[model samples]
Target: MMRHLRSIMRITWVDKVPSKEVLERTGLPSMEDLLTRKNLRWTGHLMRMSPNRLPNKSIYSQMPSVHRKRGRPRLRFKDTIKRNQKLRDIKTHSLASLSQQRDKWREIVK
Candidate 1:
């Protein structure tokens, strides 16, 4: 994407233009920011789902005990959500109540 953007603007790496400047010039959000926003939006959708729904239930489900491989444990969906929230400096404690209010959550996401 950076390469594409640079090409569109006729910028070469030799020009030593920073990627941040390129993104700003193109009026686009950084890839990380875009992903974080999507994650937050999905989390809000899950939070607003009916408790009996499968997607919502899966979020709160506990994994059963099992044998582990000789490597670092994989990150769960819950962990990813927490990481995204942390990146945005959002308070988890208030997320439940805040997410229920669509307008407020939309503002925060922006």
Candidate 2:
């Protein structure tokens, strides 16, 4: 989308697009905004789950599945989030409460 928007900007402005300038400078909403919004929404979804709802809860926990024969076990949500994010705690109970604060969780996800 950034590339396409840059292309259109260049064409419409007769080939004078700013180099490495932000989308906001052009008065446009940005991909980063969209992604962060989506992440916040997903974080909210995870935070609002109950253990009885297996799928959402299972995202931060291991699930039973067929084993692979090779390099490593398949990646799951818990593995990815834990590797990239730092938190005071990642246990299921704490995750739910911490994620209740939208801005805080957004920063962690980002």
Candidate 3:
């Protein structure tokens, strides 16, 4: 989306400023920011859910051992959470602690 937005700007003779600058000027959050917020929101939702509410706990907590046909395996959603946690430097392991604290989680997500 960022690339496409930049191309649109270029075609409009507005390439002098960076894509981020244009997005800011238009009061829109970048794609990355939107994805990050969504990821965090989903995490919060999952954390609040009971074992019965979640379709299958194994999806997030376990990976079946199997050999791939042959190619780079895609990163899983669980891996993405870990990567985001590391990137954000979240120390708490039990993110569920914030299930009842909306403001705190929002701050952490940001």
Candidate 4:
């Protein structure tokens, strides 16, 4: 339908970058105007080298969570005890060997 086609065309135009003349006419300064002289030069250099536009918000939101909050149950005393036990085991096996190796190296150097 004509209405559907017109809506699609309007959405396409929304993604277009505005021109410098339009920015001036709107009384909106460029990113360079807000940054210091050094930062402006650095920004210009980076923009010239890699002139790619940034990703949309929807793209950012789709990224995997690096950290999760599982709430109070995960941070309880039982969980702390389990974590401490694991740390103790690591220190007894791996860290103890590393400490002995460091002491041996120090004795050899001395």
Model 2, span 1-110: residue lDDT tens: 66676776664445565544647556765565555456545656766677578767566465477767988777665554553333324455566676877677766555
Error of 4 at 42 (Å): 16
The C-alpha TM-scores of every prediction are: 0.93, 0.50, 0.71, 0.18
Off by over 4 Å in 1: none
RMSD of 3: 3.4
**Clash totals for all candidate models:** 0, 0, 0, 0
Which pairs of residues collide in candidate 4?
Answer: none
lDDT of 1 at 20: 100
Q: Which stretches of candidate 4 lie over 4 Å from their true place?
A: 1-18, 37-110
lDDT of each: 0.92, 0.59, 0.72, 0.38
Ranking by lDDT: 1, 3, 2, 4
TM for candidate 1 is 0.93
Q: Residue 75 error for model 1, in Å? A: 1.0
For model 2, what is the alpha-carbon lDDT of residue 56?
Answer: 73
